[model samples]
Target: MHRLANPTRFLRLCNMVKPWAMAITLLCLATGLYFSLFKSPPDYQQSDTVRIMYVHVPAAWMAMFCYSAMALSSAAALIWGHLVAQLIAKATAPIGASFTFLALITGSLWGKPMWGTWWVWDARLTSVLILFFLYLGFIVLHDAFDDTSRGARAASILAVVGAVNVPIIKFSVDWWNTLHQPASVVKLDGPAIHSSMLVPLLLMACGYTGFYLWMLIVRMRAEFNSNKIRAIRIRQANR
Candidate 1:
């Protein structure tokens, strides 16, 4: 992690790994979609509509996972004063927000058929909505300050603080009676989901993970370059 403090070396590693990440993302998406839609047997209850789980579940997972990542990055930035870490957290906000949005939209599509309503104020749903707002709030707070460093610090603090919502989102269904179902893929007694559905679900989750990595590296590089350009312009102005 400390080695990654050097921006040039970090950029080099990202460039090397990016192509492989993209290739794997495409492969997983193709295979996962095929298995999820065509090969896997539908849930006896939800039948065809269960296919939305492939998209919704993974997006929800990524939304939570990316926020956790941001929180950790924020902690690192605050502790070690690493600008790279701060940039990572900043770049991650939009992607996490996007995944959160997908999860909400897809979950709504899944919910209407099963629950007979387009929306509900369920615990899990509400907590995830809070998570989405937290992401947006981080972005808004970051831009609210005139000094970019001050903005990053403020955003980092919010990211760290908002992490409390993650567990609430994860356990809300179990803790309260809700329209959302309890854990199917993750449980102490092993997964309750069938192997056929599980395989594609895991594949899509892996693909989404790769997609996030690919996006992160690309966005970080862009941020680094932009910062450098800004610095150069400042130097020229001072001269």
Candidate 2:
């Protein structure tokens, strides 16, 4: 982890695996979509519309996963003053927000057909909505200060504080009455979903993960360049 704090080394690592990640990402996506749309059978109750689960569930899971990553990275930044971790938290914000948005949109589309409404104030849905707001709040706070350190610190704190929402989002279905379904794929008990459906769902989840990693590397590179440009400008002004 310490070795990766060096931007050059981190970028080199990213470069080394980037091609493989991209390849795997594309492969998984293609296979996943084929299975999701064609290979896998529809739900007994919901019929063909159940296919939406392939995208909606994974995006929802990734949205929470990304926030957990950001919160952990933010903790590292606050504790060890790891600049790379701070950059990671910063870069992760938008991607997580996008995933959350996708989840919400897809959920609404599915709900409109199944639940007979486009939106609901269900516990799980409501908590996930709060998660989206938390992402935006972190981004806003990160840029609210002129001092870069202050901004990073503020965002780190916010990320840590808001992490409480992650669990709330997860358990909301179990803890309260909700329109959303309970855990099917991940549970202490064996998966409730069929093996055929699970295969495509898992593949799509992996694809989403690969996509996130690939984008993180690209975004981190841009962030490093921006920092260099800012430093050079400061030096010239001082001179």
Q: On a 0 to 100 scale, what is the lDDT of residue 222 in model 2? A: 90
Lowest lDDT sum, 10 consecutive residues, model 2, at 16-25
| Candidate 2 residue-wise lDDT, 1-239, digit = tens | 88898878988998998887898789999999999999999898999988999999989999999999999999999999988899999999999999999999999999998999999999999999999999999999998999888998999999999999999999998999999889998899989989999999999999999999988888988988988998999999999
Candidate 1 lDDT (Cα, whole model)? 0.94
lDDT of 1 by residue, 145-232 (tens): 8788898899999999999999999899899999899999878899998899999999999899999999999999999988999899
Alpha carbon lDDT of each predicted model = 0.94, 0.93
Q: Give the Cα RMSD of candidate 1.
A: 0.9
Tell me the spans in candidate 2 whose CA falls farther than 4 Å from its real position.
none
* Candidate 1 minimal-lDDT segment of 10 residues: 145-154
**Candidate 1 at 147: error in angstroms?**
0.6
lDDT of model 1 at residue 61? Answer: 98
